[model samples]
Target: MAAGGSYGAALTDLGERLVGDVITPGDADYDEARKIFNTMIDRRPAAIAQCETAPDVAHAIRFARDHVLPLAVRGGGHSVAGMSLVDGGLVIDLRRMDAVTVDPGARTATVGGGAIMSGLDRATQPYGLATTGGRVSTTGVGGFVLGGGAGFLDRAFGLACDNLLSVDLVTAQGDQLHVDEKEHPELFWALHGGGGNFGVATAFTLRLHPLTTMTAMLLLWRPEAGPAVARAYRDFFESAPGQVGGGLLYLTGPPEEFVPDDMVDTLVCAVLLTYTGHEERARAITAPLLRLGHDAEMITELPYADLQCMLDDPPGYRNYWSAEYLDSFPDQAVDRFCARASDMVVPSPSQHVLFPQGAAVTEGPSDYPLPWRGAAWIVHPFGLWDDPADDARVRQWAHDTRADVRPWSRGAVYLNFIGREGRDRVIEGFGAENYHRLAGVKALYDPDNVFRLNHNIEPRIEPRPAGR
Candidate 1:
């Protein structure tokens, strides 16, 4: 609905009823409210409802439904394809609802939907508890967990959705539900990897694990050694313990103390190894890679939360990314994966990463909609750069990276690692059977497809007999 139409009047009423502020296009914070993490996505929403509580979310949903306004849910504003924000629609901004409460006794965390990885990490750290979160601190816990989260701790703790105990969400019909194993079982099942199609997750209760001393190590090498390094990294994961996680990435070496002077501002390959124990154990586990590394190294034992921030990518970059889960990372495939790094824009936040996926990820529940977990390795190209002129350059590079690794592609993919490719890609993310099942759940809760933003799952509509 247009902002100047009946929405202007209806928006006023909705604003008064909401506990949070309702921001319109002319409002002081409208621009900031609509702004998301990806700079490439520039959209102007008609209204933005900054929801504070669960009731506020329901009210916003009802208002949007009543006025026939497109609805988008924002959590940490971190959707790479700008799924968090909608064009000329009403955004249910949940950034204000970020409050994480940790229960040390149960070793579970009840987090607000707006909570990011930092908030979650900080809350659970004092209790010596942690869960599978995103690679960086800025990623929203809701999007990450709902979309099948993968992080440095994933191999040890399993994907974020695997650790889900319960979820409190607001359906498209403006009804609040406490979904779990017992209550709303199907909806709970769909939440495993069913992005934001089912509903808006207002809160999440995640199972946590004990994590005391965590260590991180970065072994760097020149771009020429990428193929060999990739091979070694592939072999290392064959017997690597659950505590061993992280990726082999091609990135421009930053001007940090650990980066060599000559290698700075040039593309280089780095093997990032993260362990759930002390520095000694981390070194002992990754000793093989360290022996071959020559250029630079940054090894330190830090808190799990602190380690998450180490590779955090700053926002406000023109971002484009895609991933291809590999059935096998053969030496020839490794060469293709490394060769694509040359197409990436150097001195930017872009990373051509090959992450190992096995251990708990494959051994976990096979019933969930997540299909990419079974893959041996994941080739993800995360492209973040400035200047609109380089938009085509970075996009082509990310696309080419996926194409190069397609020979080893395991049919399925991780949706969270990529943006909206197409309907076929969405089906590829969730297997055919799981996709249909998730669509059935979508038909039940969001039949009208009110929540069709993130890697959308459309409701199955039965056709009528002949002409009406």
Candidate 2:
């Protein structure tokens, strides 16, 4: 709809009933409101409804429905493909609804949909409790958990969705539903890794685990040592304990106290091992990789919340990323995986990561839509760079990284680790059978596919008779 007459009038009327502000193109903060994490995404919505409550979300949904405007939901706006923003549409901005309530007694956290990893981690940290969160603290809890969250604690605690006890959602019809194992069981199952194809999740109650102390071990080596370090890292994690989690990656060595000056701002291979215990135990477990490392090392005991912020990617960088779950990472595959790192943009936040996925991840419930949980290893090409000129180069690097390791591909992927690949890849994110079931749930909640963003799951529509 055009931005005048009924469209403008509808927004004005909707704004009056909303508890939060309504931003339009002419609004002073419209640009700021639309700004997402990825600098590559530049979209202008007709109006943005900064929703503060579930009722506010319902109102925004109804307003968009009544006006026949495309609707988008924004949490942290961390979607790499910029799925949270739509051109000439209405965005239900949920950033204001970020409230975290932690219950140490029950070992649970009821997080607002807009809450980021930092808020969730910080809230649970004081209680000596934690849950599976995203790699970085800035990630939106809704999208991350809903898309099968993987992080440093995943190996020990399981995926974020695995810890989900309940989710408060606003359906396509602007109706609120409390989903959990008892109520809306099918929808709850889909929410495990189904993305936002079902509805707008207003809040989530996640199960938290005890984590008193955490340790991070960073051991770096020159880029040439990637292949050897990759092999040793892979072998080390194969038998590593569940309490151990992290990845071996090729990245620009940051100018930290432990890093050598010559290695700073240069491509370096590093093994970041995170242990869910004190530094003494972490050092003992990571002694294998410590032996092979040459350049620099930093091992310290820190709070889980503090560790979440360690790898937070700076915003406003163009991002392109893809992941391939592997059944096995043999020596040949390791060579290919390490070789592709040379193509990555140096002196950038980009990382060619090889992460091990096992322990609790494999032992978690198998009935959910998350098929990639069975993979032994995950190769993620996380591309973050500032220069628009290197866009094509960085993109090709990610694609080539995937192509190089295709032989070991496990056929399924984690949707949160990737962008908008395609319909087939989306199905692969959730296996074909799980996708079919999720589509049925989508049919029940969002038949018209109103929330057709993220890794979308299309609702199954039964056809009418020939002569309607």
Candidate 3:
């Protein structure tokens, strides 16, 4: 659809002078360029410019603006809602710019937009250093950081944005600028948790911490013990130390080498715990969790990088994740969760995960654009399936689960997990005050709203009504 005329001519002219690949629909790699992490989403972008430099990104932006084409920025192409590709639009793929520079003395690393969690971790692990990142290794640092990343180290360090030292971004006007606490502080604040609505981030400098070995474990309990397991997990997390980070989930056993044949398709509740501390100390701290009436306890000490990738799910798997922040996990809610866990289809492997929040994540809501601060827990209903025919069933199940838990939630959702729900949901994600502020920042840097993908925040030329 976007293969000819002035748009194609402009791309061709730029490609001749650029260092990266400019692929059109007719190209052999077009299919791969358009493919994102979720196989359920099949999008065909008109053109995908794999950028190698910031100037190339700026050029792509200018070309898109000149052609009046919808633009999607792809950094690892892992958006749950598949916002990284727009049919017949220009896709600026940053995956080619995967450069990383580490400042060991300063404990900071500057990563290119295309860098994935695995790449970053590999680079930093040699120095026994790490930064806040997503749990999965394939997750792109750009999207994860911009959306307020949470991972194993979050409780010890903070959210990914909290550790961000600076970022290089290309604006709608084809201008490149460095943003941080000192320069363009407002834009920097918005970039932290404002999703990808501000500008196209070219690179990020993140603060890292020394992390050597950590104790990580997967404790599995039968479905019948869901209630007891949930209660114990809730109580343990309520008073857990800042060094401890874990989440509870109900899932069907994976067909792995370690899983018994009988348990392969059985419903089970699992607790994933990771303690970033000395081996002995971590074992002592998590001893109670290992003893929590589980059918199995698979605990071990491993490198931090290994622990980070332990939960990596394969790409192309159909998934729908919905989340809500809870003030507290009430007894009734626990009962409901247990009951729901027992009713799950044994072979489907759908899950309800509750991640505890406090300390690093419970700071003032004003500290970042992300709302839902101080919420005790984040409940995520994750649906996974491979059958195209069962798509509706999986999606509806997640939706219903989230709806059922809404009454006890903080009425806010995590941007990364939200789908194409609507602008209203986007507003609710960041709260009124924060959303308006983010909109103002968006207007100042990207007046035309060039970066409208992700959980978009509309540019505000004037002040909005209170509680908008």
Candidate 4:
């Protein structure tokens, strides 16, 4: 069952048919190519097909099926669970296909499936247009959008999947399909938040909006200010305009010009408010937080693309992330959330975050299988560190963070926000009814469940008669 030449000439024939490089174990870049964002994942795929075209993807899919090799699709390779890789299988590495084409007149952008948020943001920046993208630039557009993407502009623009206009995908049977409202409509609905259970998307055309100006304001305080800051932030953000998006987080203070020497390398509380407008308007909306006598502050008006990279978490750190959606952030919930910050491994890239969700996010289409979108608040424990000794501790912190907020929990979760919890949680993410419908779609496009490396939705198979 190994993915090497044991499949005979089929492996060699696949290499000949592909328009991209067929990288194997002995290749010079195999080790580096196999690396993903999470340092803890050390998988070795038998063959890494760096696909550059739709044909390449189709060929790779057929190759894996013919050889009976486990198939994994790699876009940004940012899956916290390392879903983009397989230990001894074939990987459809789409990193080389990253490309972005913007149509300012039409207010839309056609993004290559492998394109990252940074590429999309930069491409649209010149046209004063953008869509909801990931919090950081490195996130894969395919996985982000398909999983109901959220970001600094989500409250203003809506989830990335909300902006999806069309998707060109290759199914498990090596069939190419252009899915939208008119064609393969059932599959289109599942694509809204279904992750990658259906197929390997080659490209996505997304609706873009005018975003000529953006402002970012960061107010920092000592770790002790977490509870008060969290409460005030909760109250301020609840009524703020949709244009305002950001969160309160506790992170190890970086050695930056805006960070105080005493705060650097120590856990510090920060309230970042991003406004999709000019600095003056952002300042007006964030004045309440500014008046809290922050020990350090930074306010700037910059392009959205520039702001997207400001909080980019460095890779090569062991990561374990999980989130809890809340109906309301009451004083008790705020206290519990703040209390968990003490458990975080300080001086690392970890962040204990509280994000507000409402406005465009809540008002977005309800038909999509994004049950967590209605939640008013999201408590995210994003743990990243270097030492394996802290593995148990970091993972426990994330789990305990979720447990702390269970009282006010909305009972639904964002699948992209957490690693694999269980099948029940996955069903909860898309609701029972929606999951049932998505399972049907999975049955149509991928009945054999070829693409099961995501927040997987198993194909729903019906029982047949006793005898044919």
- In model 3, the runs with Cα more than 4 Å from the true position are 1-6, 342-349, 463-468
Better of 1 and 2 by lDDT: 2
lDDT of 3: 0.83
Can you tell me which runs of candidate 2 are displaced by over 4 Å? 1-6, 463-468
Residue-wise C-alpha lDDT for candidate 4, range 443-463, written one tens digit per residue: 999999999988899999878
- TM-score for each of the candidates: 0.97, 0.98, 0.95, 0.98
Q: State the lDDT at 55 in candidate 4.
A: 90
Q: Taking the tens digit of each residue's C-alpha lDDT, what string does model 2 give over 1-468?
A: 123444788788888889998898887777899999999999988999999999999999998888788899999899999999998889999999899999999999999999999999999999999999988999999999999899999899998889999999999999999999999999999899998888899999999999988999888999998898888888898899999999999999999988989999999999899999998888888888888847898888999999999999999899999999999999999999988889989999999999999999999999999999999999999999999999999999999999989998999999988999999999999999998889888999999889996789999876888999
Counted clashes in each candidate structure: 0, 0, 0, 0
Per residue, candidate 1 scores C-alpha lDDT tens digits across 1-468 of 123544788888888898888888877767777888898899988888889999999999898788787888999888888988888788999988899999899999999998899999999998899999999999999999999999999899899999999999999998999999999999999999998898888899999999987998888999998888888889989999988999999998989987879999999999899999999877888888888946888889999999999999987788998899988988888888888899888889899998999999988999999889999999889999998899899889888888887988988998988888999999999999999999889999999999988898999876788987
Error of 2 at 383 (Å): 0.7
Candidate 2 residue pairs in backbone clash = none
The all-Cα superposition gives candidate 3 an RMSD in Å to the true structure of: 2.9
> How accurate locally, in lDDT, is each candidate?
0.90, 0.91, 0.83, 0.92
Error of 3 at 326 (Å): 0.4
Better of 1 and 4 by lDDT: 4
Query: Model 2, residue 334: what's the lDDT?
Result: 92
Question: Model 3 shows how many backbone clashes?
Answer: 0
Give the CA lDDT, 0 to 100, for residue 227 in model 2.
90
